[model samples]
Target: MDDRVAGALSLPEDWPAHPDLSLALNRMGSFDWDLDSGLMHLDRPALDVFDLRPEEYNDRPADLGQRVPEDEGARLDTMLVQALEAGQESYGAYFRCRLRDGSLRWTHTQGFIRRDADGRPRRILGIVRDASQELADSVARQELDEERRRRTSLVQATSAALAHARTVQDVIDVLKNSRGLAHLGAANIVMGLLEAGRIHLVAEGPEGSFVPGTRYTKVDERYPMSEVLRTLTPRFIETPDDFARSYPELWGQISHLGVTSAAYLPLIAQAHPIGALGLLYDDRAVFAGDERNLLVSLSSSIAQSLQRAMLYEQEHDLAEGLQQAMLPRRIPEVPGAQVAVRYRSARLGRDIGGDWYDVIPLPGGRVGAVIGDVQGHDTHAAAVMGQLRIVLRAYAAEGHSPATVMARASVFLQELDTDRFATCIYAEADLTTGVMQMVRAGHMEPLVRDPDGSCHKLFVEGGLPLGLSAEFGSLDYPVSTVELDPGHTLVFYTDGLVELPDTDLDGGMRLLTEMVRNGPQDIRRLADQLCESVDGYGGEDDVAVLLLRRDAVPSPQPGGRLRQHVAQNDPEALSSARHMIRAAVRAWGAGERADEIELTADELITNALLHTDGGAIVTIRILAGGERRLRVDVEDRSSALPRRRDAGDAGVSGRGLMLVDRLADVWGVESRGGGKCVWSEFLIPERFERPGRHEPPAHHELPDRRDRGGRDRGGRDRGGRGGAGRERPGGDGAPREP
Candidate 1:
């Protein structure tokens, strides 16, 4: 007791001499493995670390499987193998250990690799310890870091969604529908916009949570939203009692909703409060510091989006109103045909377009159909469209030819102060005669639907668009005369109808053609069908459509007449003239004399074009006298009279005067204005004048009106006019077809 240092130590019976005493105190143990023999040894402390008694584990590490989970043991083996193969000096890992109670506990093992002098791994020395206490402390920190990451992700997701919101309502929808508020433990949301010193509630929390008097509340009112808006600061309610005490007026109504807590944040943008947002939680009673900060940041993002959306909607409304006002108010009912028109605005905000359609009633039983789109998608485009529409209608009303109308309109657009140009297609349709004079100005081809529901596009001679034609000095839009047989439909549309993302023009056209063929027969229904089809393709651009279908049976009383302008060398114009005559004859019940009348009319038209320097204008009408004769007149600008002439039998020449005199009951020539009218007539039966039936006689298969008399429309030259059919003059009768 007196003195030696060894004698002064206080040791237990298992202390100083026990090798594992120090390791057991620290819950650590050692291990030794013989790699070549595949055997391992664990000291008493190591065996305790694995929760195995002395008899439970043998020298083999595999015997420790009763305490160490199979997966953990395999992981330890893999770690040792990798360490030995690399000649690593150390390795460590934490794995689950099975305890005596069948509960798994975390355990860690660190090993040191022992190598032979030649560098071969001979064995591993290591220590094993229980890591449950070490890992428990870190678990709390991990949870905190994970929460921070989730909140950051929440802000990013919400901002991304708000960035696409284009209206105030859109911002509300994102909050309600995108689960942005749900992540914050908010069962529902309430939002209010500040307007005119008042709070206008845009969203009233969850379903059936609307407060009776809170929809419109004053800034001084006893409401949470109003309080936040007035103070421009966020308010956090800790509990239902806190909400009830702070604002008893509002809490009384929402108390039944089981809202235990809430956070009302002022929506401030650029230092100005524009609105307020309320996040109501049905279960939670308090908001953490991080939750409060996150909600504040989200409020800032929502404020910015709401302000942007509000501005966008305001501008969109003004521009859309301007566009609608500029367009035609209504389409009038056209005689002898069914007409339909439609328009759809674009999907983007403030992208109002200049697409427009109009139906103008013209003189002489004719009507003007117009479909056009100006160059842009803005207010300026709408203004230009309005001006162009007015001036165009004025020119057409003045009885100008289709080509002249388009040319003058082009010049007008060129004179306007705007740099925009418009693509337009103008058609002057003679409903009674089944004829149309089409002029295209840098626009898409018009589609024609046959009686059998076949669709095809017309390739008319085209000039530059409205403003461009005058700029390029190419105002001569040649006229393409088209024949619309009874029961046929003419379709005019802006490019929007045939446009789709990632599709070429031809593909779009094919899709449109197929839809038109299968669409409803009625013009009104067909127009609706086409508009519905546009919705499927994502209508990024505005569209305007016009459909005109000729009456199946054109039955006009007496005084029904049709006229066409024939160009000097344009076969289409000439053929159109013939169809005009043919349709008039059959429509007015002169089918019996159709052959005789058609021959006489052709001879006179050929004479007018060949003998004169200019083209001729042909007019056919049913004379309303007791005789009920059908009259035909071909007028030219030349004042010279047509004199009867003779041709030899071998002549490809003028017996036209003799043939007309034979076929027509009366034929004559007279000078009028600065020109002369070569006239012919055939007396139709009295029974035909009454026309008890709507259709022509069945025996006569009406010939093709496009190209008749073995003459093609594309031919540029014809034999001399000295043929046997040539005419100089004849008796007092006009040439026409039946």
Candidate 2:
């Protein structure tokens, strides 16, 4: 070799090359690395392996390690040091090298360690081989494996989150907040469901991507979600241009959101497409086959879960509607008694169970409490429960005994042709006598708590459940009687109270007896505590409870009388009568019925003014007794009696008398020899009575001044006719009684 060539190659003149070694070195690139001097010499083949010119090669041996990738260079240095320390004759290393063009190439170096005279390492002579293609194939396989692992993890997390959702909104919340979707590179996630022929957006990620509940016509071809629903296929949009071309109408909106790529996958359940799932990305995204397949699989699970949640939500709403329509609006207020009722549906069922309770005010100031349960927990059972309740209420209102009401209701249920059986317990309490009569029909016995807080059950003899047999005439439900003394309580309930899953009838009854014995004194608070105590066990059946406590009777107030004066022929007395009646009823604490009483008084007063020469005298008497009565009387000098006339719908005048008859509990006409006094009595509801309110002074009794000709001797005309009657309003025609 010439001096310049040797200098460029960094080679010595005495370098030895055996034939076998020379042949091996010729095929692969050879290099000499100096251990102490830190100089390197490369052959022409070695220079070509690095893709470098001879002039570009640096003489420093450390420069070769710098040419390798940083990580590989560190590894190579470790391997060289270990080999030299072990005094090995040969050592090899494979490393990634950076070429002049800044590209990576996998290179393998095999060298022999040359030792000095003292057996210490001096230099290394090595051959370099390019392994770029082999390393590239290995790296591709590793990348594919990692991608698969990531996809699998995402799918598992998504399925788990969706599985726990119980409602449609819950599913929406999961999709919007799941970390798995974000990890999978989703910037915006939107879910649209087909509802009533329109695609409605149900859920969105990162807020503002799509408005929830925004609707689009399913038939519109420009909407991507609608298209997915129509075709039941997936769509992958690679760029904003693709979205603009496919769905021009929505492109403006999508572009404004900075969405560059999107994927719309149809969510199919039970071989039908119900909705679509959309994933959007701000940057360009390309989905590979594996990723696409993973998304499709995830969508299938999401669809089924979402469908279940939606169905549950629909059924839940329907069940609630049925319950609200059937249940009583408010419990009736019984005198000397505090009543409370509670109802709870089964926790683990799809159907709304047939549990019902009712408080009916029977005649003679008595209250009837009814509690029952149908055999099933379904919409049909609930309907039957409502119907059965109405029938029982009608029978009780007719003043039938508890046993007779049960027998009649049983026959009614059988005749209705409903394929369901019901267990019931009905009880009637006489508020005046503090006596209770109860009857059971295949139901649990009534629980009673005495004034001393001692509890016991009344094991009344009961017949078969309603609708169980056609022998209603033979079925005799025996009535059991118990005295509800002052501070005593009576409990009526269905089998759900003492038939828990974990406890038998005896055990449950004992537990209930304890709870009631130690319960709060307030009827409402006791009802709540009883329900919470028993219902904490996750009951399998619906529960219904009715609690009635007879409080100590209050002292009666003195009777109050209100009298309003009316001129013999004054038309303005009608308004004055209404005002007087309203004020009297309100002061008596019967304000809830004030409107009805005022109307009734106005009708009677107007009738007297229209038909009689002398105007009517309006008297309102508030009686304070066991059952309070509000009596309104109108006495006039007319002999004509008001008869009930069949009034047409459009005729307003004749309906006044009809309203008085319908609104008043009892009404009659009393003739005091001359004039007739028409009186109407209204039994005030117990809720209106103020317990400790003072009463007004009683009024003096007025003598009967009626004559046989229907003209009152005291109310005879004293020159108060027509114009004169209007001028002397407070004169002879004025009210005589204070």
For each candidate, C-alpha RMSD in Å?
7.9, 19.8
**Top candidate, metric TM-score:** 1
Minimum summed lDDT over a 10-residue window in model 1 is located at: 716-725
Q: What TM-score would every model get versus the actual structure?
A: 0.83, 0.47
Model 1, residue 532: displacement in angstroms? 4.5
Clashes of each: 26, 3
- Candidate 1, which segments miss by more than 4 Å at Cα? 1-26, 32-48, 53-63, 116-123, 136-143, 210-215, 241-260, 448-461, 485-488, 518-526, 558-561, 622-629, 644-676, 679-683, 686-738
Candidate 1 differs from the real structure by a C-alpha RMSD in angstroms, to one decimal, of: 7.9
Tell me the tens digit of each residue's lDDT in model 2 across 34-53.
97888888877777777767
- Which runs of model 2 end up more than 4 angstroms from their true locations? 1-167, 170-189, 204-224, 230-232, 236-262, 269-272, 279-286, 304-350, 411-420, 432-434, 442-738
Best by lDDT: 1
- Taking all chains together, the TM-score of candidate 2 against the true structure is 0.47
